[model samples]
Target: MIPYVREIQFEYGACDQVSPLIRRVVANNPGPFTYLGTGTYIIGKGEVAVIDPGPDMPDHLEALLAALEGETVTHILVTHHHTDHSPLARPLQEKTGAKIYGCAVGAKAGDSAVITEAGHDLDFSPDIDICGGGAVFEGPGWTLEAIATPGHTSNHICFALKEENALFSGDHIMGWSTTVVSPPDGDMTAYMDSLDKVKARGFDILWPTHGPPVRDVAPFIEAYIAHRRAREAQVLKALADGHGRIKDMIPTLYAEVDKRLWPAAARSVLGHMIDLVRRGIVVTDAPEPGLDSDYRLAG
Candidate 1:
């Protein structure tokens, strides 16, 4: 198991200070994917920085503005271009006159993958691509180092708070659930590499956007990587046993998973197959390996 953290105590549109410098305001939007909702983070005190402005709900925006009644929002930092994560950035920026900083506009993923909670927002263009240059953002009392962790999307970026030795891990590494790596934007190979990059950073805590903090950093990450490796092993085993298509492997591979999430699971499996095909461990019959592609082990 990945030691998933599912419990969180918070009210909708209420900004609660979870740490000395971090105040989180949960959006009213809730579902199977979003857990309680998108937790928009406010970092620092006087001149604050906001991470993951979340969905474009008017009430959520009002609550955010209310939370920073006296403070100046100098920077609005986004994690990725997912509709749940970055759609409010534009409206928030208009209200506070804060410069938006984070990943660039997202490239279109394949049409087959439907990101259930909120789809990608192609219109979300940041003022600064933090991945370029030094990738550092500083506020009154905090400094955030942007770590490019593309996998969930080609443009995903996680921010590390240097003052607290914590990372505001976006959708890259959630504490609640395993990240959805759908293609062609979601690359399993890049996702695995990013996991290694984060593990090497050795942060004390990870405050994911969707759920509560991950306190046990090292072991949790190890389990996460191990879980993926195990999934790969299972995929190979399935391929060896005559399960050559993603749809065929789904029932056994994700037997415990809810049927509703099977489509999402299929997309993830496709990501793995794409990686496997690239490494020459498997061969695909389709022009490009996709959800419907047939696969077999290399001779």
Candidate 2:
């Protein structure tokens, strides 16, 4: 289902109680990446666990604090270290004295050349690094099963709520827009693998960090996998048609796409090219494939 702004009827700063245990406070940091806004969820009542505190904005924090007027924030769980998702965790931790948990040790990007500060929150380091194993965090009335579904970023994760039969999918899967797999941190191979990983779990619902909830997760995952596969096919066809550079491929593959989003599209194209190079399906002139690097079908 398409996540149009008109369909999402929630107002900013209002703590809409979605469930008996979960309350959502969406941040007003809407952008191309953050469709509508960042959804900061407070799971459980009395002693609750805050998921994705959203961007470091005073208003958003006030809204969260207001929502938890009589409640205590026990755990502040972050899905990833993206600026829009994790920066507010520190401030919330300072205020509520809640322990911060997230993927601390991430798979290193090839290089930080393509990385932007606006996207990555470099200062974010969790008190408890919940990576590697499938760690289950239990509390007063809730249990969050941490599943490491790294794709959008190396440290990316999705948490399944035992109480609700749902997964806080973070930015790994969103109904608003297709997850952007931009390198050097964004690996196309890892992303596709993670999609398969998430699909296998088969959760009842997926509440993304941005946009509306995905109720039909199985079909959605299938569609996601199919979309990526189609993009990969397009990249292959572009290579076959002798469009070597990522810039050329962007125009050819994403002709109908917005001009402003083409740079991001180029990065995604580079991601696909690098993945193809790794698979020996495509070869590049440079040792590491880049935006300017030339690519071709493997001999």
Candidate 3:
């Protein structure tokens, strides 16, 4: 089968108007992983707010500034600390004199800890680290309330747009591809819980950072949760049927997938393995099960 496909039709450097209050500028960093680069969302009217400022690239920053030429960027909010998701917050903050806000970066390590997706900006310190809900940013005919949906990463946040009844779903729930749950930064348990948290919320549509907007919110979320459960069940069966290592188990689980994506697929399998280990259903040869660790069902 082919590798993971991205359905969103986007061109880098084009600021397309998605709605009455939202204008999206796609960055020139598209790849197998990033899809059609990063979508830097310009929200609100005259005085607007930017979400997920994208990479701190020269052209992307210029595009963002040019998008808000006459308007002032009052605030900049990022969903998480990933390079593609953030990094430009600092530059934009300096250019527009807006305060940057996001969750704290995952703790840095020296190669001893479990692997996570790389290139997190540790220097990003927000003037006000929004503690998810209870805080609201009100603009002209719009209201943005932070949703604490920490699944992709520990500090990920999805902003709920009150006026449109939509959500600025960052990497947490992208319409293009499933969010990668890489441990120890990503927790399958927390990821599943956050999906439930989002399901319980009231939102009509989702404007994800990577791909197109998900209009079918309820069914999409339900399918996402069900897919994860099925994956977990498959992992359990792999262990029960004498397959242990992630290398061996991925083929059985993702045989329809292309071989090139197995590495990324393995990371996701590791997430399930870690979740199983935590729940006392699986055990690994290594005390801390990383990408290369061997796993088996618990006695």
Say which candidate scores most in TM-score: 1
Candidate number achieving the greatest lDDT relative to the actual structure: 1
TM-score for each predicted model, relative to the true structure: 0.97, 0.94, 0.92
Q: Please, what are the lDDT tens digits per residue for candidate 2 over residues 1-299?
A: 33322246689999888777778899998887787899999898788999999899999999999998888888899998888999999999888999999988454643566564337887789999887638888879899988887768888878899878899999899977778787878778989998898889878888899988888888888888888889899999988888877787777788876676777778888888888898899997797788888889999
Pick out the ten consecutive residues of candidate 3 with the lowest summed lDDT: 109-118
- Backbone clash pairs for candidate 1 read none
Indicate whether candidate 1 or candidate 3 has the larger TM-score: 1
Model 1: what TM-score?
0.97
Show model 1 residue runs off by greater than 4 Å.
110-115
lDDT of 1: 0.89
To one decimal, what is the Cα RMSD in angstroms of model 2 from the true structure?
2.0
- Model 1 clash count equals 0
Candidate 2 lDDT score at position 15 = 89
* Model 3 lDDT on a 0 to 1 scale: 0.81
lDDT of residue 243 for candidate 2: 84
Write the residue-wise lDDT of candidate 3 on 1-299 in tens digits.
Answer: 11233577666787889998899999998765576788999888798889999987999999888889999888798888877888989988889999887777667412234333435666666788875654788778778888888767778888988888899999888787777877667778899999998889857999988878888888888888888999999988887888878888888888977676667688788889888888999988796887778788888
State in Å the error of residue 226, model 2: 0.4
